[model samples]
Target chain A: MTGTLFLQTLVDGLILGGIFSLSAVGFSLIFGVLGVVNLSHGIFVLLGAYLGLALKEAWGIDPLMAIPLVFGALFVLGGLVQITLVSGAVRRGSLMSSLLITFGVSLMLRDLIILVFGPDVQSLSSSWLFDTFRIGGVIVDGARASGLIASLLSLGLLSYVLYRSKVGRAMRATAQQDFAAGLCGIDVKKIYAMTFGVSAGFAGVSGIIVGLINPFTPFDDTHWTLNAFVTVVLGGVGSPVGALLGGLMLGGISTFSSQYVGSLYPNVFIFGALLLMLIVRPNGLLGNAYKGSV
Target chain B: MNKQISRRTALGLLGATMTSATALRAMPARAATDGVIRFGGSLGMSGRYAETGLNIRHGYETAIKYINEEKGGVQIAGKTYSLELGIVDDASDPARATTLIQRQVDEGVDFFLGSYGSNVVLPCAGITEAAGKVTVQVGGSADQIFTQGYENIFGFFPRASRAWVTSIEFFKSIEPKPKTVSVMATNSAFSKLNAQAAAAGCKEIGLEVLDVLELPEQVTDSSSALATLRARTPDILITTTVDQNSLVIARQMIATETNVPLLYQFLGPQLPAYRESLGAKADGVVMQLPWDESLEFTDPTFGDTQSYIDYYNATNDRPFSYHTVGASSCITTYIEAMKAAGSVDPLAVRDALDAIDIVTAFGPVNFTEDGDGDPILMGAKIGQVQGGEIKVVYPENLRTAETLYPTPTWAEKG
Candidate 1:
């Protein structure tokens, strides 16, 4: 490939990685805090997009402007679901039950969205953001650039919360050892609910970005959920930084394979890489080796 | 004396009631011969293919409504029988389609109207063929469906392989005559065949095939694909995928500013929803379709092409797509076959379908030995989105507008 083409592909891959990283971090947070895989995480993203679309169409609010509303709404919804349905599974400490319950929740949410939206593809349009600009012989999409910036800001804020806040310390302590943290005066159940809320807020932000970048349908969740799972596993299962690295790696591999090898074989390359990663380092690049949490 | 007579009478009455219940259980078998011609099929009403499935359902319903109200039903074997359509939502799952087809067969539906997508139709075809039922379909055009040697399934549209022939032919007719082409399609069987056909046809017409890409079905982004194409920079770009995939590709093309002289998408660009989604970006994109509202044709059931359009617009939320027209044609073709055979029997209708030749609101309907519609009679026509309207630009006689050669670049348009 020529230098310009290679650069263009790299730019595209990184843009895709930014979105994937946001989604993976959300998924990773839930798993890290609750020790329960949130299979419905992708649906939270889709639901957020739909809400953004609704806000845009009904109230003339731009998708970017409506992001905060989407995030808050999803956070509340996620918190309610955790309190009402998921707490029982977590209390019982049955991982399979948690997986199955969340899977069921995902299915129900997908069906509900389909009922409301009628399975037609919906897109978020920003006239100015959809244009393209050239940067040193490489084409860059305005929407993707904005999405990348938004992803970084969200990730930075999440890191600040995790590392610099009192609640963040309590959440970490509970994740490490709920019993010990409870004895130390942390409200473990409340921390779980808060973690789920924050995790879903991340998904909400990612969803708006995704909708701005691509047209989405109700069925898009499963595809994204699978990609997030792959990203989490490839990165350290419960590590946000690892998820970011894994997302970038996957995006680069998908883009390069589609460009050089064949578009048809990108999935093959992705899964193959996943297999190799699992075999070589099951705990992932940054995962806790002894914990084997994932 | 009254009490003694009641004991024997009660025993006789109980035996008579038991006999009546047994007779009532056998009533459904007789209902099949009750002079009502029932058509049954499954539609993808709830999943990825739901929009297209809804269009097909509306088309079939419109045609059936026209037949019953305007044409006064079909006269078979010296008696007039009204048409009844029994539809079930398969939720776009092939397994559900098979199960629904078997249920319809058991319920004694006289024939089947095929559902949308080749994946669903192929499995439904197998079930219908095994049950000795005849199915008239417009959704599936995969070559595999024809090669199965099943005489029961009849297609109303041209094969998937020839779906893009008219678009290629239109390109050849342009003044500059585009020479290089890049083709991409979703990796599904139907889409793959569509892309392969476009590539092969372009080669046959002396255009250099720059690239042929098969993207995964679940791909939500196309930036990398567009970036790859930017290096090659073909004169023409062709996409053979569903509406959503096509829309994504089109938007990404605009975002990346990858401009070509001509762009043709197999199915998406023809629909009103697609145009609405992309707005101005939808302009200058050419499409190939079997039928459009502009076509001038008269049908016995629905007065004429214009009338059909009026009816569809009046009833449905969106304008009639090619899928709607193709689906309506399937029902009309079956009605014509029944008229020719003078019977509602599945075997007789299947034979008559092979023998009958007629034109409907969509186009001419003639099934070849392989049970596929003859491309010569029902070939695809090229349409281009110009000034926010889809206009027929090819086939000379049916041309509503002249072909706009060398579509303007995104920057130029802006």
Candidate 2:
């Protein structure tokens, strides 16, 4: 590839990496804190995008301006779902039951989305940020650049919340050992609900960013969920910083593989890398972020 | 061609014929008691292609109304048989689609209608081709589908390879005509084939082929490809993409300012969702389509283009699309072939389909033995989305609007 082409791919990879990182941090959090794989995570993201789209079309609200609305709606729904379904599923059969329940809920919500929005692909357009900025020979589109900024800000805020707050301390304690944390005066169930809510809300925030950069359909939920899972696996299962490392790695691998290797080989390369990572370091590059010694 | 039957009644008749399969198998696809001829197959009604599948269903249902009530049914050897549709939702699953076709074949439904996209049609047609059943479809355009020597599978649409091959004349007419071109194709079987064919066509017509950018299957960005375009800056950019890919790539192209003088998407711009997403940005972006509403063609089936549009609009909640007509022509061709052969026999009708040239609501119909459609009819017209609507911009005589040559770049439009 030419030097210019290489530089462009590198820039594109970083932007894509930002999107992947923000979209997955919540998934990593949920997986670590609850030990319940949230298969329905992707739908929350889609719900945010759809909500943004509806707001845009119905009232001429910009997608960027509607992120808070989308985030609030999904956060409440996620908390309620954690209390009602996820907690009940965990009670019935632990992690496997939770997994199945999340999968079923994902399918149900996916169908609901189709019914509400139709199965057509949709993209978000912003009146405020639709321009192409150029730096010498490099071209940066406004949609992607805006998405990258949102992702970074969201990630930075999430880090502050996870490390510098009492709630963050409780969440980490519960993630490490819920029984011990409960004995130590942490309200384990409430913490779980809050973690799930935060994870889901962050997922929704990322979804709006995704909609800004890429065209999405209801069926794309599974793809987003899977991507987040891979990000966690490649970086470290439970850390925002790990999700960032993993997402950027994935973004680079995807772009380089598609550009230099072949268009058809990105998935193969990604999965192969995932398998290799698992074999080399089961705990991941930085290891679990929250889990402490039992 | 005067009588009108309730389209709902035709659907009920379609359902009614399912129970009379014992008589259907004993006879040659004809139910003696109800005079109902069953046409069944699997379509993607609830999956990735659900929208196109629903449109095809409307096309099939509408054609059934015309065949049974207006055209007085399929006349063959002094007997008439009303058409009944027996379709199942395959949900775009290749294995399930083939299995459904096989199930219908086992149950003795001889005539088959095709589903949308090559993925569904490829396997479904394989089942019908093996059963010695005739499948008249509009979706299977990949050259491998035809070159597979599947004689029973007839594509009533443009072959994937001939997409740009058919556009040669149109390109020749461009003002300050293009000399260099680039291609960006997604990872679908049809898209890849169409892109390769476009490159070949460019070479044939002496246009310099800068590059063929095969986009990642789940592409969110195209920076590397855009950079190549920036460096090369080809006069024209040809992209082979479907609705989703088109929207994503088009958005990316606009953002990256990877603007060319002309940009053409093979399929995406014609879809409603893509048009809605792009809005006025869709204008000047030319696309290739098998049928447009403006073609001045007349046939006994739907009279002409205007009537077809009217009937479609009267029934469907949405505006008319080209695929609806393509779907309707499948039934029209089967009826016309059976009438021409004067027999309801599967082999006889298939042979007659190979020979007869008849006009339908969609256009002309004549399937080559290799299962290709009438080339003259399936020209895949060049359509430029003008004034927020697609209009024919080529083949001079069928031109509905003037060709917006040297399509405005993204920067120019902005």
Deviation (Å) of B256 in candidate 2: 0.6
Candidate 1, clashing residue pairs? none
lDDT of 1 by residue, A52-135 (tens): 889988998988889899999988989988998889888988889989988888999999998887787788887675677889
What pairs collide in candidate 2? Answer: none
Native A-B contact fraction in model 2:
0.62
lDDT of 2 by residue, B257-311 (tens): 7778889888789887787777777778988868877676776678886887787
The lowest-lDDT stretch of 10 consecutive residues in candidate 2 chain B is B25-34
Minimum summed lDDT over a 10-residue window in model 1 chain A is located at A285-294
Put down candidate 1 lDDT per residue, B1-414, tens digits, no spaces.
898789889988998999988888645433433366788999998788988888888888888777766666667777777777888899999999999899888888869999988999999999899889999998888888888899899887667775566766787898787879999888888788888888998899999999887788866777767877777889889898888899888888888898888888887887776887778877789888678787888876677888888887876775567778888888888888988988878899999999978878887888889898887777888889988999899988889998887899866765
- Each prediction's DockQ? 0.64, 0.55
